[model samples]
Target: MKIIAMSDSHGDRETVKTVSNLSGNAFFHCGDSELSFDDPLLEKFHTVRGNCDSDHRFPSNVLVEIGDKKVLAVHGHEHDVKRSMMMLYYTAKEQGANIVLFGHSHLYGAEVEDGILFLNPGSTRLPRGGNEATFAVIEWDKTLRISFQNLNGEVIDSLEIKNFTKEH
Candidate 1:
């Protein structure tokens, strides 16, 4: 299975659409989607409310079960992501997820800890500090692997999550 993940669009529909069309796979908007609840995409998409998305009627996070994988998605702002990963880490475990996707830092982050995978797809609209407008794709198979891409669909980074589960 493949999941296209992105966050912090902050109302930039064009940027979101560009990346959205990059994959024919499932899509997850971590938060800051900044779109309306009735957005056509949300009907079949997994999304959460961001700090700016408060105007919309959606939760700040969501748990999705896809292809035997429990995935947690959040905006990250509430978790104080910049200071540390403690809050986000516990939340993922509490959610019983093997993978967690989040946004708010507008910076890409990924790691594997104690059988959990954490990922962040930086802002597609306004990236920080020389960061390119980016998004991510998690290709889940026997091993969950990640590929980070720029708006041009060029992969700028990659990772293989470790210790996230018993070999399946």
Candidate 2:
């Protein structure tokens, strides 16, 4: 399965559309989009509510099942992600999820811990910690391959993670 994850657009519809156009089987918006839930572009994404989002129609989190993997998607603020990922980690564990997808700090990063994949796609409009606006593509088969790409579809970083899947 191929999954595209992004967040913190802050109203950049064009960037969101661009990222959505990428080749992937699934798409996620980690929030802070500041766009309406009814927006056509958002319709293609599995979205969560961001701190900046006022759309009550959007849920605060979502659990997506892809193949045998369970992915937990959230905006990260409720879990106090700016401070640490500990809370989010525990939450994912409790949900029996193999992957946790989130964004809020506008910084792109990925890590594997105790068979869980934690990813933050950063901000597509206002990126912190670097200049390049970024998103991530995760290709999962027997292993997980993550490619962090720029808006132009150029890869900036790539990570191949093995043994990161939760045993059934």
Assess each prediction's global lDDT (C-alpha) against the native: 0.82, 0.91
Instruction: Extract clashing residue pairs from model 1.
Output: none
Clashes of each: 0, 0
Best by TM-score: 2
Error of 2 at 77 (Å): 0.6
Per-residue lDDT of 6-103 in model 1, one digit per residue for the tens? 99888888877786666546788888878898877555568888888856678888898877788899888899998889999999878888889998
| Candidate 1, position 27, lDDT | 84
Residue-wise lDDT of candidate 2 within 19-125, one digit each (tens)?
A: 98888888999999999999999888999999999888999999999778898999999999999999999999999988889999999999888878999988899
TM-score of each: 0.91, 0.96
Candidate 1 residue 31 C-alpha distance from true site, Å: 1.3
Off by over 4 Å in 1: 41-43, 162-168
- How does candidate 1 score on lDDT? 0.82
